[model samples]
Target: MTETRFYPKGEGMTLAELAALCEGELRDGADAGHRVDGLAALDDAGPRDIGFFDNNRYAAVLAETRAGGVLIARRSVHLVPPGVAALVVRDPGRAFALAGRALFPDALLPTGLELGGISDRAFVDPSAVLEEGVIVEPQAVIGPRAVIGRGTHVGAGAVIGPGCQIGRDCRIGWHASIQHALIGDRVILHPGVRLGQDGFGYSAGRDGILKMVQIGRVIIQDGVEIGANTTIDRGAIRDTVIGENTKIDNQVQIGHNVRVGRNCMIVAQVALAGSVTLGDGVAIGGQSAVNNHVTVGDGAQIAAISSVAGDVPAGARWGGVPAKPVRDWFREVTWVSEMAKQRRVPEVRHGRDDNDA
Candidate 1:
């Protein structure tokens, strides 16, 4: 069954149009006049849908796919099923992505927000300043003295707290909350994102646990994209900073005063404890975590599920629990596997004495 989509279906396109849009060459015998109604994965595609095939591991699925056409690597075109048109490209994934964006332009663009107007159901404080071309959707709340720049869209149920400054061409997604934040132009906060929430700071005293107020802001630089349900806590003192062009995945937890440098890619469920600093071009894999006050140098890559507790040098790859250099981790794993195999005891024969002790 095809998955239900929230966005409206795109207008169907001819195979020839799709090939031109994706910068791919149509293989001979492909029906140029055939229309592709939608995009789907290899396993779920129907006769009128277009799909992509890049990995050889899924060659069986490609062979059975019922798609009208497929965006495929030039080397893998032979794997496509009979009757399926092959659009061969140097980079199949990139070509498919381009085709998807072109085909679903409206679905990819921001919706639900009224351009250059505020919905009647939205509440904007009298003192809040909205520049020209700002869009505030239904049930959105704009707090006092907040400044929203032109071409920004605040989605339904989104909250912009007092004194917040959001820059131009930004899109704050539905139900996302922003407080004590300074966001730069073209920043995209996906649905359910929580920015500037209070940091987990408390003092255990004789009287009881004393909560410390989080007064610092979250500074999101231009072109940053934060994924859904990701929470970035406000600093206890200094500001938490996300640098320009950083892309953070869903459900990431960034603690107080964490500094993420430009063009960093933090994958889903990654956690950075308080005061952690990441240099530019770092890539942290899914479910990994960095301990408090650790510094990851520029261009370092942390593998999935790693638990980093110390500083990582620039251009290094780290992995494993209490993360170490990836090569060292691999060596240790190999040694342990060999040792376990060597220690394995062979089962004794029981041919003559079932009851002997």
Candidate 2:
């Protein structure tokens, strides 16, 4: 079983200290002397944990949590549990996040690279079978236990880690580093793509120092195409899975343990946090980011530059930062266009209008 550490339940900073750290105002609640440490989701909170609510949807769970205290915005102070201390903030989510970080910092990975790599210009295992059409370029390192299937092209300077499995007809681009990763058939990994790198894990000590530990692998299914400079981190615990036929565009950063479903189109510059789940056929536009552990439902469409901070239902089309439905976004865009119309230089219509001769 994975280690589950709890926060400092009763012996930690006061509500006042938390308020100061978040630069928030405390509204009506129990004494500021209340001690808080652990943080949990509103639905899964216990007496030792401090639950938070930024949106009204979680208001139902506010009274249900066994948490000793609650953190909420000033407007929702009335929803606080009876006799429970409240840490009021302008953004309860942000405050809770800060509190969680203070309580549980990530564990980092070790940086112990091998002393010396394989001597051969193209290092391949004897047990592994390569087809006649397969090409392993110079300085390409294929590990001792790795298997590169038929017609696969291992580009120059590519590093395939020990025990890796590359399927048939795959294109492993130049200078790509794949460690502890499984690549399926027909996959196209462009140059500079990094798969199965150690995740950014850090465990904070009493001395306020952090330690790193590498513990995971990456799994890419068949028919996937990863663009140039895209980075896919290995899992922190389980496998970071990219489903079949998924097209990930340039410069995307997919964090550890993420599960991206099949046929998903993740556009350029997208940042998917650790453990995020995307259902099948999801389309994420350029520069969008999904929060950690959030589930994006199937067939959902998110517009460019959107910041998704919450769950999106199946087939939903959303836009904007902290994304909402496209209908809501359309109204907002219309309003913005109306406001900015007068500020812009007036344009003369080239084509004929209704009054044209």
Candidate 3:
């Protein structure tokens, strides 16, 4: 016999009612009383599932969907099949995301330790404070001056190094290392993340080598989410700061003394050199590199494979090596192509050839 499993349902939302609640005009007649338990794609939706279609490429699947209701863009509203309830909107993707959050809210973790679970063999300093709802998993070490706030979760084999501070609702993933860092509320450090690591600093004297001291700290503000295996180096003199609500993707390298502003979206494999300053709401594409001491203004977008070498104006889009303005780069490309064409003209080519005589 198969074991029974329970799936939680959303409160007070039916398929037809959800479709009517959307601001877009409806495309087909739909029953407002039918219940929907979750969100799904058009192809994978069941009787109780609500699906969405944002692209016209999936119109065939949308027309055959059994979903109770479908959220679709205004342009795609005509694709809704008969007897299907269509929630028309300008951005179907964003609408779908909102619907998912409403249909399946995140459940909070239960508080306090429970019996029948194996505890880890780890060292927690007597002077350290672990607040309510905090969990320190097996083989994890909490230092003497460390304080983990309420609802914080530290995974197994992770090290909260000496003098570190972690705020409430934060998550430290497995095998991560944090030293002399200040992590804010709701921040997430994924597995294998390395924070506050010693920066590459050294001086070679006439006689021998001199190691430069790194006395700075890593400061991550509230609502920041760091991806797995990313490395954020500590500052050389000041703090390596990541502003609030900034999302960093996996395998990114943030060098010492980098200042990133609020709500920035940094994609994977990005390397920011030391002392780089990025204004708020900047979006950096994957594999982009910003040179040292460069400043990127607010709302600037750096496309993928770009190598930024100078200051970028606010709200501009930059690309290519040395990272010039997109318009200027395109103009230069057009000029070069036109010049090459002019040089290849038969009359011009013969004149230039005879001029050598």
Which residue pairs collide in model 3, if any? Answer: none
Clash count for each candidate, listed in order shown: 0, 8, 0
Q: In candidate 2, what are the lDDT values of residues 1-357, reduced to their tens digit?
A: 112452223455777777787777666656677666667676666655677887788777787767766778888988887776777788878887787666554311111122222335777777665666677877788777788888777787888888888899788888889998988998989888999998777778888858566588899999999998999999998999999999999999999989999999999999999889999999999999999999999999999999999999999999897799999989998999999986755445786454555
Quick one: ranking by TM-score, best first?
1, 3, 2
What does the lDDT read for residue 215 in candidate 2?
A: 81
TM-score of each: 0.87, 0.60, 0.82
Best by the lDDT measure: 1
Q: How high is the lDDT of residue 318 in model 1? A: 97
Higher-TM-score candidate of 2 and 3 = 3
Q: Please give the lDDT score at residue 325 for candidate 3.
A: 90
Instruction: Encode model 3's per-residue lDDT on 1-357: one tens digit a residue.
Output: 111123356464775566545655556466667777776678778767778887777878988998777888777778888877787877777777767767665522222223222245767888888888787877888988898999888887889988799999887888889997999999988888999998877799897888888889999999999988999999999999999999999999999999999999999999999999999999999999999999999999999989999999999999878799988877888998899988854444744854465
Identify the candidate with maximal TM-score.
1
TM-score of candidate 3 relative to the true fold? 0.82
